[model samples]
Target: MLPDALPSRWYPIFSSAQLRRAPTVVERLGERLVLWRDAAGRAHAALDRCPHRGVSFKTATVNQAGELVCPYHGFTFSPKGPCAHAPVLGRDAKPPAMSLDIRNVTEAHGLIWAFTGAVEADTPPPPWFEGLGDDLRRCADIAEEWPVHHVQLTQSMLDIYHVGVLHRRTAPGSGQVITDFTMTTTEDEVHTEGRLGHEGAKGMPFVARLRLPGLVHLDVGFGLHVLVGVTPIDAKRSWVWARYEARLTPLPQLDGVIAWLGAKYDFTVLQHMEDLPLLKSIEPAVPEPGVDRLIAPDAGAAAYLRLYRRALSGRMEVAQ
Candidate 1:
């Protein structure tokens, strides 16, 4: 089982393009959820079970009225989860005092975000990278399921020291030494700036930042930006959503080509050829505070762990 105290925040679980008019089922945050779109193309999320018969909503269908209809019976539910109609009770009969388990969801940044925390009147919009505006075009949108816990996967993303060593083959000439590394932690964010040292050469500078609840932004220069969302499918599995974007030239029409090339060479080669193998080999799958020895090079990851613990304990408010 996952930790009982997971931080209450919004998590991006599905790509916007993946959810169409048909109802789709997904396992996220250790719960089975049903996602669907209405006639107007808006998205809705709920527990993947019918309230009346406990039938899985995986086989449900969307009615013309934009309500979800259970396949077993004709019981219907609205996007917000209220029982809209019951075929057995007659068309004019009032619906029973029942409701589907509704989940708060919204669409932004080409992804569907679900609120894991309690829904309140003041629930904020999903967090996003500052410069990811309409000007930048997405080149690659990839989603992969990893067999390791989300905590470990997220920690690996923050651990910059592993790049030069683990990706040495794919990224030859990149040295294993890290120099001039500095990390800063705010209420709900951790920012790390560092340089990768190489023999007889000036180090390469990079900047990485993490937002609470598993949002990461990595900038390695050259107008390429990588954004990743690490969402837990369960205690032992995680879904990683990676978006590669670029604004290489003044011609917006050529943005896609630039982004595609960058993702093909950098993201694909590094993640598949080098990262996944090492990530799957981590022991215990989940990370424990005192189980491993962390060094100076791991300052960013260490700070993230501390902040994550605090968030899980409900001691800090997650910034939007």
Candidate 2:
């Protein structure tokens, strides 16, 4: 059931820079997937198992022709997963269909996205950050492996109350007790707005966009945004990718250097170092609602769960 809920949507399996000369192995939705790039730099994903003798693609190699070669049987497969050549059949014979089970894959925003289910020409494109454009430049891309359910890490982002407490020293002056907190939700998004201290102070508005199968966007103010994507490695592990980007300023000389430094410092000290240790300490993985008492400050996390459940229901409806 957990695995089925993750299909039919795109998941960022690798960053564009990570796929180089060799084939890479990725575990998503409880399956071992092999990702490789063709001669033209197009990415593809398929079950790691070879059709003959079930040898894992981890032991295989990408041949000069851009086809994945099975070391055990010398069968060559195309990017679309069909076996194109076999040594036993000589050069002229065509291999049978369904020789390799390939899935859908595409690249965008410097990330390699892989679809875990069937995809047609009309399948929707992966979700994009609304305000980002070509003018903006990527400053940092941080990828890490977490020891909890993907849901746990996602909900943490939505937990507005934790800011003042969990990140007091790392992210001081932010996440103070929010006043007049109100939360709004949509089929796949959530919004929360409030003040850090008393009334009349500057408002801190948080808008979180969620896509089925684990993709989220968190705006970090100052024309900077963070993109968080969680790929379920298995039932107990998840791979996380976070990207920090900022708009280009008028001064090209200092913009690039400043953006890089700010992104690296905040991400390393403020976010990754501060949050990872606390998140790793949470027990029982995914916690059920009402298991712990909730106060008014938890409005953001609560709203996130509602939208998340709605997405799951929508997926089930489509299946029916």
Candidate 3:
């Protein structure tokens, strides 16, 4: 679920594969922006609007310089976003004077990340995953647009009790409770952060634990991290983007297991189906300035919900 607002967090927006060749515009939360690769083969994100006529640069052409040229009036802008030239005017002539909020773009571990809000390069890295090893294969992508909020989907990750009742395969409880799980709730809007690691567990890593939301970061062992990004397309829809990162060994080596694990997690679509009835069933949440009391499992759920609420609030303030 993409929020009606934006978060100041740095999230994975696109994979390296999708950002190649031509420019692509992602419309999210009622906002428009463009992503394209430069001549040096570096991916760049910039405000999609052409300062000249407010036309989208995403619909423009990629020039020999690899800069995005607006299709409407043929206005070309550099990766830095300064209008490099106006086709009607010769190169020697004065170019359009404008710039876009070209955020810093970084490609890592086969993914492209865009820093939203006031993220600092010096900021500490995101959480570290365990049991993460090589051999993660990209079998199928379960990307869909949600008709609800992004937090709704994120909160679903830390839901352990529902595993047995909702998702029957992974943690099917034959009327028996699973092993002990450690769930911690802190004073952060990031409500839920818990882990259920069963030793000699049945699966790829022997024991699996929750690492991150939507990411499904499960550390199978040291240096092995499987991260999946459940990106939002808008307040009503989003995409489920996942990747298997190989840190110690090459992924090609464990294609079979990775494929198996990928299949194991194939319930993403099913998960959405589960959410469909609930999300669509939600009759536009009642704006209660703030939430009231929360239950036990709700403790973790509340933390994440609050984390996202604050994040969206900070963004809305800035956008205003």
Please name the candidate that would achieve the greatest TM-score relative to the true structure.
1
The CA-based lDDT of model 2 is what? 0.71
Q: State residue 121's C-alpha deviation in candidate 2, in Å.
A: 3.2
List model 1 lDDT by residue over 77-191, tens digit each.
9998889888898888757678999988999988999987777889878878777633435457778888878888888888766777887887676687777888999978999
Any idea what lDDT model 3 has?
Answer: 0.55
Candidate 2 residue-wise lDDT at 209: 53
Winner by TM-score between candidate 3 and candidate 1: 1
Ranking by lDDT: 1, 2, 3
For model 1, the stretches where C-alpha displacement exceeds 4 angstroms are 1-5, 133-138, 264-268, 315-320
RMSD of 1: 3.0
lDDT of 2 at 95: 69
| lDDT, candidate 3, at 317 | 81
Tens digits of lDDT, candidate 2, 276-301: 77777877665667865777767766
Clashes of 3: 24
lDDT of 1: 0.81
Off by over 4 Å in 2: 1-4, 94-98, 133-138, 197-209, 252-256, 313-320
